[model samples]
Target: MTPTLSEVTVGDELPALTVPVTRADLVRYAGASGDFNPIHWNERFATEVGLPDVIAHGMLTMALAGRIVTEWAGDPGAVARYSVRFTRPVVVPDDGVGTEITVTGKVAAINEDGTVKVTITAKAADQAVLGGAQAHVRLP
Candidate 1:
């Protein structure tokens, strides 16, 4: 169920989420997004670019972080605005297991317009992938 405005408050933390990002997932995302960047799929190119390995797309990491709030609000449309800065890359090795991303969210402020400002932290392999991540969400 969607959370009511009154039920939310500053410092209220949403449930944490974890998602595994695989090479196949990157390929699919590239196909859907028309971002056939070599660094995302080519290990040699990524290495040449100084990246540890093939990395997940920044937008993918942002979307995964947003999922933590959307799931808590129980409605995708409830999110009014979302933004994040790419800080680190999420390395996805060729191993089938892939890399895991962890997202944690908290209510940062309650807005006068029945919306809440949520602060989000996203990490992969103990390194932050997104910086200054926050979402503005409308409540019921």
Candidate 2:
């Protein structure tokens, strides 16, 4: 069921989403989003550009965070506005551990139209990935 606007509070926490940042994942995201940035698909280019490895698209990580909120709110269209800062690069690896995105949200303000300004704290594997991630959502 969709959550009512009045049901959310100032310190509500959204469930965490763990996504593996693999080389294949980056390649697929690049194709899907039309963001074939070398840093996200070419290891040699990424290394030449001083990145650790082929990095995942920033938008991909942001989309994961958005999923957390949209799932909690029970409707993707309920999200009126969403934004995040790419504080760190999501490096794709051939093996070993992957990244984890955890989203904790708080109601910053309630609008006259029943929309809520949500302030989200997004982290990746315990590191702050996106600071000041926020969304304006109209709850059912």
Off by over 4 Å in 2: none
Q: List the residue pairs that clash in candidate 2.
A: none
RMSD (CA, angstroms), candidate 2: 1.9
Tens digit of per-residue lDDT, candidate 2, span 2-79: 679778776665665555567777778888989988898778999998998777788998887778778878899999
RMSD (CA, Å), each prediction: 0.8, 1.9
Q: Looking at candidate 2, what is the lDDT of residue 82?
A: 95
Q: Compared with the true structure, what per-residue lDDT tens digits does model 1 show for residues 1-140?
A: 56789988799999899999999999999999999999999999999989999999888888888999999989999899999999999999998999999999999999888789999999999989999999999888
Cα-lDDT of candidate 2: 0.78
